[model samples]
Target: MLLVIGPGAVGTVLAGYLSAAGRSVRLLCPESALPALSAADEIVIDRVTGGPPLRAPKPLLTTTVNPERVTQIFICVKQPDLESVCDLIPPALPPSVPLVSMLNAPSAVHRLRERFPQHTALPASVLFNAQLLEPFRARVTTVPRIQLPFEHRQVVESFAGTGIRPVRAFGEASAWGKLLLNLSNAIAAVTHSTFRDILSNPLLRASYADLLDEAIRVLRAARIPFRAPLPVSLSAYQMMMRHAGALPWWLARWKWRLAEGAYPSMVSDIAHGRPTEADALNGEIVRVAARAGVDAPLNAKMVTLVEQVGAQRPPRYLSPAELRSALGHHLQT
Candidate 1:
């Protein structure tokens, strides 16, 4: 049996996928989600790319883990909740249960490994966007795929004939590659802009470019192998950024294909008054930059902005220009 912890966007969508593929799955959610989870007989997945809604038979939901039946565990909580999730694992499951980290933080894999030194914690990346529109309903904007490090071929075979795609990564390189695209999530959270709007605005794109460039510099200085998350190469992405007008067209029509209606996870987190994964996203860059003796001013500023917004009861959405000016003001300080 597969135990998927957390009923948020990532957990719910993945539970749907596995259950639809005929796997025996269970969802372990917080007490807050019990009412919604109990009410829904099935999980509704609204595909944004023009497909009939997918209704998967909802799996059993509980607040506690049954270590006896759970053969494998997937930690799908937001970054802020990760440490708590880590603490929940050791006593609940046997040390050998294969654990997969699906959170967006590039450093999450390492953190999980450190936390559970005895377990086989595999690093994986989710290259899709899922939003929890309701307690039991989710909107998935991208076709879901899991990228696993090459060392986990046995785990890869577990998904055989399940329609779930798993790509073998080149070590930690895949996580860093995915981080390039995730840098924009903080932007969306702060600006309340859809993916299209963020890409379309010249100033916003410039800010995003700075964030990406800063991450690349930190990665280079740290001697970490990095790849472009988009279909194009890093060089091609740099070339595209040089021409602002071309950037949005590429993002909307080719690269991202993210629907205008899609909201990033952090955006939804702030909207729901849940803690945002600012540390996992921009804060990771700031940490790496600090260790490398490099200044990631844009990411640093974003980290501050996201933390401040996350603390609000009703998070105020900053305008794109406002976010841009804030970052600019910090750079000048």
Candidate 2:
């Protein structure tokens, strides 16, 4: 059985997909989330295949159950909620039941591994960008793709056909690769733009490239092997920025059309007055850079901007130029 904790966009996406795949998936959420979810039977994914909308019936299990019955538990909560969520997992869960965390940062894996020493703790990174449109409806801007670098092959295999395929990362190298990609979330969020937006803008694109470079440096300093995929790679991304003017007009327009529906998680946090994973996303970069004796001014500035915006007395939008100015020192250099 799959127990998906925190019925937010990520959790809902997994629940909807797995349930549609005929898996015994159960959604465990707080009382507050029930009202928004109780009345809906479908999750709308606008990013994957236009807007036909994906539906998952009331397969949601609201009541708490014995943890032992939960063979696999997917912790889909935000980074800040990790400790609190971990506390909620009953100790009675069988020692063999593996706990998979779909958190973005590298720190979450180490922390969860320490907290759930009795159970098999695996760190799984999700690649899709999901947004909750309403209580029960969510739009998946990206396909549901995930890579888990845990040592347990069997545990990863169990989720093979459930729309969340786990990729094996023999050691810490794979985890680092996931972390490198996650750095883009903050850039996309701070700009109040989609991934395509950030990638399209020459300045924003350069900012992203520099951020990844900083991340790569930090990983190398820590002796962690970090590799990025094509398009997202440091060199390839820089080339894209340099040749920004050469893209076909039609291709650029199509990219924007696709990104128009994409909603960033940090932007959602700001809109809803909820604390975001700034600490995990950008703050993680700062922490690691400091440890490695390197300065990650771009990420550090983004962390500050996100926190300040999130805490403002009267919420206001931080313009792209203003945000770019904030990171001027790093960018100008």
Best of the candidates, TM-score? 1
For model 2, the superposed segments whose C-alpha errors exceed 4 Å read: 42-47, 63-65, 150-153, 163-170, 231-233, 242-259, 331-333
Error of 1 at 16 (Å): 0.3
List TM-scores for all candidates, in order.
0.92, 0.87
lDDT of 1 by residue, 1-333 (tens): 888989988898888878887888999887877987898879888876666877889998877778889888888988878787877774657887888888887677788888878888876888778888787689888666688776666567656665457877766788888888789889988887777766777877777877888788888998888765567678777556657564655565554456767767788777778777777888888888889888788888898888888787788888878887888875634
RMSD of every candidate to native, in Å, equals 2.2, 3.1
lDDT to native, each model: 0.79, 0.70
Candidate 2 backbone collisions, by pair: none
Superposed on all Cα atoms, model 2 deviates from the true structure by an RMSD in Å of: 3.1
**Ten-residue segment with the worst summed lDDT in candidate 1?**
248-257
Which candidate leads in lDDT? Answer: 1
Instruction: Summarize candidate 2's per-residue lDDT along 1-333 as a digit string, tens digits.
Output: 888887888888888777877878888888777776777756554456465667666556664746756888888889888888888788788888878888877677788789878887777777667887776577776556677654676666656776555555545556667677667677766656666666666666667667777777777786676655333455665566556543422243353233444656887787667888877877877788788887777788878877777777555666667766677777635
